[model samples]
Target: MSTSWRDRFEKNFISPEKKLGLDEILEEAHDAYLGWLAASLTAFHSDFNEDQVDQLDRIFQGESRIRSIANDCYNYAINGRFRLAKDAQEQEQMNDDWVCLAILVQSARPGIEEFSLTVRGRPIGVPAKLEQLLFHAQIRALLDFSTVDGFDEESVSVPQFFSQPVPGYLTLKEIALLGQMSERAVRNAAQPAAADRLQTRKEQTQTVVDATEALRWLKGRRGFIATRAD
Candidate 1:
């Protein structure tokens, strides 16, 4: 049997007499996607406890809604309804949402990376635990960077969201290179933001940037990101 949203999508293509605009078509497709997602989660719920099932439902549903909204943003970007900066902002938001979706789904996925065994049936090892923590931190970092919500799923050019680098640890030399400054200048800039985030070793004598902490700093202090000429 065809679903309500599925019927709508099918109608959009099959009902030649009916005329719907691009925006309407996008909404119909997005709603169908949500319906598919809800059905998938309902199936997955049988394997999880109440708490985990709730969380899984929330994570999937959350992105499903965001995808609908961001699809509009994507349309605006392509249609030139807004400025270049607006396009960039939409691109960045899409990127953020994509990252969040990956982290959330993988963190909740049943199987370990190395094997097909579900977390429900087996004890999570050190690697799995670390992966979960890293996902949480990435989510927090995304929140710290943008007050606006994030989104993704549709394919597009320009921003290349999937290809963008996930923020990673920055060595002193790397930070300096990214900032287009001397190593001394990088150290000076780090000093102010280094209060609680300083990750150092007595043996190494060099502070390292954990990926999440590094993202927070890079997002705000994007001195190295050269802007296109207006």
Candidate 2:
């Protein structure tokens, strides 16, 4: 049988046979979990590429909960108490992360979608794509609880542009996509009279935002991830 995520995690992270210490286990949890998730993706699709794996690593590394829970799971398992209720909760969430990962795989391997559907229950609320989930998670992580105010249809729109290597000189539409804002909102923000106006310039007839200003503007917006360091 293929090794399950639980089994893989225990073998590599818990390392019960080797009797590693808590600090040792926690120190390697992030990278170990990255490999564990990559292995999970490989289980679903053999053709999964490095770029996709790197993207997955980046997404979950930025997500603190993943490493925290992996460390907790390791800590509890070290004491031979692997079946705690909290570990059960963590496992359930990990399953959801795997499902989200399957969505990422779906573009390259469409058949994975059918497999994902088999495992998923009927949607309980508004359905979200993986990008939206990551965006919202970033918001919750970086900002105060009270600052995360409201959501609308646009709020759930994928920040697809944020995934690029560098967000150099974005167009109005690109800025809109990156910020999950409507074109009208992005356009208004670029105007000279607008409050906190973006540093924009006309390239031929169309206006574009400088990457530096773009980052500054996005820092204040909800669901923005600084993929590139300033």
Question: In terms of lDDT, which candidate is strongest?
Answer: 2
lDDT of 2: 0.42
TM-score of each: 0.25, 0.34
Model 1 residue 174 lDDT? 45
In model 2, the number of clashes is 0
Alpha-carbon runs more than 4 Å astray in model 2: 1-103, 106-109, 112-116, 120-128, 131-167, 204-206, 222-230
Give lDDT tens digits, candidate 2, residues 45-158: 854555776787687663365445444333322221222123445545544543443233223223333233211122111112222323222222222112223211122222
What residue runs in model 1 are displaced by over 4 Å at the alpha carbon? 1-23, 42-57, 60-78, 82-91, 97-158, 162-230
lDDT of 1 by residue, 1-230 (tens): 11342243333322211222345434433333333333344465533443553465576666355455434333332221211223666768655654553433333333332222333233432222222222222333222222212322232322343332333354554444333345565566566576534342222575766544544554455343322211
Q: Against the unseen true structure, what C-alpha lDDT does each candidate score?
A: 0.38, 0.42
RMSD of each: 18.4, 18.4
